[model samples]
Target: MVNDMDNIAGTLQQSLIQIITSVLTVIGVFILMLTISWKLTIIALVTIPLSILVVAFVAPTSQRLFGRQQAALGKINDQVEETYAAHTIVRTFNKEEDEEKEFNRRNHQYYQSAWKAQFFSSLMMPMMIFIRNVGYLVVAVVGAIQVIHGQITLGNVQAFLQYTNQFSQPIAQIANLSNTIQQTIASAERIFEVLDEPEMDDKIKETPVLAGKNLPKVEFKDIQFSYTDEPLIQDFNLKAPRDKMVAIVGPTSAGKTTIINLLERFYDPQGGHVYLDGQDIGSMTRDDLRKHIAIVLQDTWLFTGTIFENIKYGNENASDEEVYHAAKMARADAFIRELPDGYQTVPDESASNISQGQRQLLTIARAFLADPEILILDEATSSVDTRTEVLIQEAMNALQQERTSFVVAHRLSTIRKADQIVVVNHGKIIETGNHESLMNQKGFYAALYNSQFAGN
Candidate 1:
C-alpha cells in the first residue's frame, strides 16, 4: 500500500510537467502547420480523434488491470510478512513447504495481473504511433497533389509535412503518458478509499460531567457490543471502584481482552457509554481518555531502539533516572543492566535478542513509568518464569496502590487476592466476587479454579 502510493505520487508529479509541455508543444506545432497549409493541417487533425478513441478503448482496461495488479501485490506483501514473522512457528511445525506454496500462489497472482496491465498500457503507444503514421501518409499524398497543381508550393508542402510530424510527436508523447495516468488513478483510488472513511469524533463536549464522588473510577453502563452480526457483551455492566484491583479471568475467546479494549476506548460500545470519573468517555478526546490509562498487553512489542528509549516511550518527558526507577519497579532493570550495552542495548527489529520474558518486563516497566490513574495488565506475566512472576506481582501490587487497576489473567492463581474477580464466559459475567467468596459458592469460578489444581 505504501509503495504503491509513493509510485502514484511520483507519477503525478512528473506527469504534471510532461503533460503541460506536451500540450503547449502540440498547440504551437498545430499553429505552425496551419500557417504552412490549412489543408494539410486539417488532414493531421483526423489523428487526434483516433488517438482519443484508442485511449477511450484502452484506459479502462488498463486501469482495471492495474487495480488488480496492486491488489495482488498487496496479497504478496501480506503473505511474505506473515510467513517471515511466524517463521519460528512454521519451522517448529514442519510447515515450511505449506508456507512456500502459499507464497508462490500469491506471487503467481501478482505476475498474472502485472503482465496484463503492462500489456494493455504498452498497447497505447503503438496504437498512437500507427494513427500518427497514417495521418502523415494522408497529409503527404494530398500535399504532393496540391503542390503539383500550383495551389501550394513544394517548399511550403515540405515545411507542412515537417510540422505534421512535430504535431504528431507531442500527441504520441501524451498518449504514452496515458499508462502512467491510469496507474496513478488506480493507486489514488486505494488511497482515497481510506481517506474517505468517516473520522472518529474528536470533539470534546462542553460542560463535561465529572465523576460522582461515590462513583467507580471506571464504569461500563449497559454496554452492548458485537464484532459481527452475532451479539456479544449485550447489556454488560461493570464498575471498578477507585484505587481497587479488578481481575477479569476467563477461557479463550471469553471476551476478557475485549473488556479491556472497551475501557481503553479502543472500541466504543455499539449501545452504551463508558464513563471515566463519571464523565462520558465519548465526550472526551481519545488522547485525554488514554492519558489517564496505560496498558501492558500479552504481546510485547519493542521497536528497534535502545532499552532506555523503549521504556521511556511510556513517558517521553521522563528523566533517565525515572526510567531506570520504573524498570526496577517492573523487575526489568536487572536483566537490562546485565546486557552488553546495558540501557543502551538496541534490540533487533523483532527484539528477539532479548528473552520473551524480558520483553514483557520492559512493557511492564513502560506502563509503570506512565504513572496512569488506570493501569491495565493483560496477561502481563504470561511470558515470565515463576520466579519473575512473583517479583512482577510484587511490583504491580505496589504500582496498583491508590490507583484503579484491571488485570486480565488466564491463570486462576494470579488473581486470588483481587478485590473483584469477574468470571466471564462468552461475553457476560457469569460470576463476580472475591476468589474466596466464589470458591465457597462452588460455582463456575470454583470449578474452573479447582480444575487447574486437580492434578496437584
Candidate 2:
C-alpha cells in the first residue's frame, strides 16, 4: 500500500507540474499580447475560446486512441518475450511461421492505433494556425479603416499586427498542451490499474510465531478447490504425520501440485479446512506457515549470483560450513569443487551457466540449507537424466528421514519405496497403500504401474 500511494503521488505531481508549466507559458504569451494593442488583444481573445472548444472536442478521441495503442503495444511486447524465452521449443515444434503471423497481427493493430492518435494530434497545430490567420486578416482590415478615420495611429496598426501574432502563439501552445495532458492521463490510468489491485490479505489476524525447533503435522479435511467454476477436489482429506515422509502419486492433472499450493496457502480452499499441527492453517500467519516448509521443484530458478549466495538465500544467516554440509548432502559439493571458483562460481542469469541436473542439485542444496521441518519435492527429478535422477533420489532419501515430506513424482521407481503411496485420478484419491499392496489390488495404481513398466 505504501508503494502504491508513492507511485500515485509521484505520477500526480509530475502531471501537475507539466500542466502548471504549460498554463504559465500560455499566460505569459497572453500578457505579451496585451502590450501590443488593445484592438488586436480583443481579436486574439476571440480565438482563445474557439481553441478551447476545438481541443475539448478532439481530446477525448485522441486519448482513447492513444490508450488503445499502448495496450496493443503491451500485447506485442508479451508475444515477443514469450517467443524469445521459448525459442528452442518454437523451433522444435516448427511454430516459427505461426508465431510470426501472430506477431504481425498484433503489430499491425498497434501501428493502426498509433497512426490514428498521431493524425488527430497533428491536426491541432494546423487548426490553431488557420484560426489565427483568420483573426490576423480581421485585425488588419479593421485597423486600416481606423487609421484612415484618424481613430488609430500608423504605429498602433503595426502594434495590432504584432499582438495578433502573440495571441496566436498561445493557441498553438494550447494544442500541444492538450495532447500532452491527454497522454499523461492515459499513462496514469495504466499505472493505477496495477496499484489498485488487492494484495493477499493476511489470514491470521494475530501475529503467531512458531519456534523453529519442532514442527507440526499437516491435515487437509474435506478440502475442495477449483481454478475455474468447475470443481477440482470435491471432498478430499489427507493427514501428514509430523516428521514422516508421505508421497503422493497421481496421473496428470490429478491436483497433485494443487495440494502443494494449498499446503503453502498460495490459495485458500474454496471449501473445507487445512490444519497445521492442531491449529487451523487460516489461524496461522502466512510467514509462520511458510517458515516451516521448503520446496524444491523440477524446474529450478537461480538468479545471477555465486553458488554460495544462491544457497544462502534459503538461510541468509547460515555459516559457510552449514552451506557446504547441505551441498555435500545433496551431492552438489563435488560439482561445485569442480567449477573454476568452487562455491564462488557465479551462475548466469536463469542459471544458464550450469546444466539442468546441476541446477536441480543446487536447488536441493538450497532447500537443505534452510532445514525446514516440512519439505515438498514436486517432480524434482523428472527433468534430469537417469544418472542424475539416481543421484538426486539418493540425496532425497537422506533428506526425507525424520522430516515431514511430500513427494510428487511420475517415475514409479521413486515412490515404490515410499512408506505410503496415494494414487489420485481426476482430483480424487482412488487408492492408498504400499506399492506391493496397490499392485496386488490391480486397480488404478496397478494399471498405471503396468503401463509405466510394460516394456521394461
Candidate 3:
C-alpha cells in the first residue's frame, strides 16, 4: 500500500489521459498514412499487434511482482513500527543488532520485489520500439524501391516514413502508461478490499423507558465466548447494582479484560447477553451505548494539544473552571501548573515533555470532566505514584457515588473496598466477595492476595 502511495498519486490520472490521447493520435495518423500509401500503412499496422502482444505478456508478471513488493513494504513498515515503539526496551535488552538485521532483511526483500516489477514494466517500451523500428526500416526500404521505379512519389515516401513513426508512437506511450495503470489497479484493489469487508451490526433499537427497582445496571448471563473456536467463558453470570464499584481481578491473560470487553460491547458473546439498564447492549447503537461511559485505560493517550485541551477532550463543552476542577480532583493540577507553559503546554507523540504518570493524570482528569453515567477503570492508577493513586482513588470514590463503575485491578489494595471483587482464572469466576469476606473464605482470591503479600 505504501509502495502504491509513492507511485500512484503522481501518475495514475495523467497516464489515463495519456492512454486515451495516444490511442486517438494513433487512429488519426493511420488515416493520414492511408491517403499517402496503403502499402506503407499496412506495413506499419503489422508491428502494432506484436507490441500489444509484448505488453499483454509482461502485464501479469508486473502485477504479481508489484503485489510482492507491496507485501514486503508492509512488512518493513510493521517492523519499523514495532522496533521504534519499543525503542527503550530494545536498547535496554541490547537487541539492536537483531532488530537491524530484521529491518535489513525486509528492506532487501522489498528491493528484490521492486526490482523485478520495474524490470518487467521496463521491458515493454524497448520491445515496442524494436518492433516499431523494424517496421520503420522495412517501410523506408520498400518505399525507396517503389520511388526509384516511379511506382510512388518521393514526397509520398517521406510522408509515409513520418506517418509510420506517428502510428507506433501511441503504442510506445501505451507501454509507459501500462506501469502506472498496473500499480493504480493494485492500489485500488487493496483499498477496496478493505472497504468490502464485513462490518459489525450497527442497528439502533428504539430505547424503551424502564421503571423497575430490580434492574441490573450491567449484567452478563450465561455468557459464552472465545477469540478462537474454543469456548473461553462457557456460562458466565454477573449482576451489579446501578451505583457501586465491581472489580475484576485475575492473572495476566486469565480473561479479566475480556469481561470488560464484552460489557463494553467491543466483542459480543457467542451466547447469552450483556444488558445495560435493562436493555440488551447488542440492540443499542454502539455510539449511544458508549456515550454514557468513560474508560481510563492503563496506557494513556493524549494527542497534540495543550493540557487544558486534553482535559476538556471528553467534555468539549466543559468550562475552563470545570477542567481546572477535574485536574485538581485527579491530583494533576500541581504538576501541570509547574510546567513552563502551565496548562498551555502541548504533549504529543514525542512524549518527552510529560512523564507517564502525568499523562495518566491528564486522562483521569479528562474522564472526570465527562461526568459519565458509567465509569470503567482498566488499571487506571498503575502509572501514578502511591500518593497520586490514593488521590485518584478518592476522586473515583466521589465519582462512583451515584453511578455504576467497573474496575479491573491487579493490585489487591486498589480494590479492597470494592463492593464486589470477582476472582477470575481459566476464564471462570472462581470466587466473589469483599476483601475481608474473600480472605475469610481462603479461596482463589485469598490465595492471590496472600501471594502478593508473601515474603513482605
Q: TM-score of each candidate? A: 0.92, 0.84, 0.89
Candidate 3 structure quality by residue, lDDT tens digits, 361-402: 788888889988899999988777888788778777766778
Error of 3 at 272 (Å): 1.2
Model 3 residue runs over 4 Å out of place are 13-48, 137-157, 187-193, 203-212
Write down the RMSD of all candidates, one decimal each.
2.4, 4.8, 3.0
Model number with the top TM-score: 1
Candidate 2: list runs displaced more than 4 Å. 1-20, 29-46, 92-95, 134-171, 177-191, 203-216
Q: Is candidate 1 or candidate 3 better by TM-score?
A: 1
Those runs of model 1 whose alpha carbons end farther than 4 Å from true positions after fitting are 13-17, 149-151, 203-212
39-142 in candidate 1: lDDT tens per residue?
A: 77888999999999999999999999999998898888888888888888999999999988988998999999999999989999999999999998999899
Error of 3 at 328 (Å): 2.8
lDDT of 1 at 235: 79
Model 1 whole-model lDDT (C-alpha atoms)? 0.88
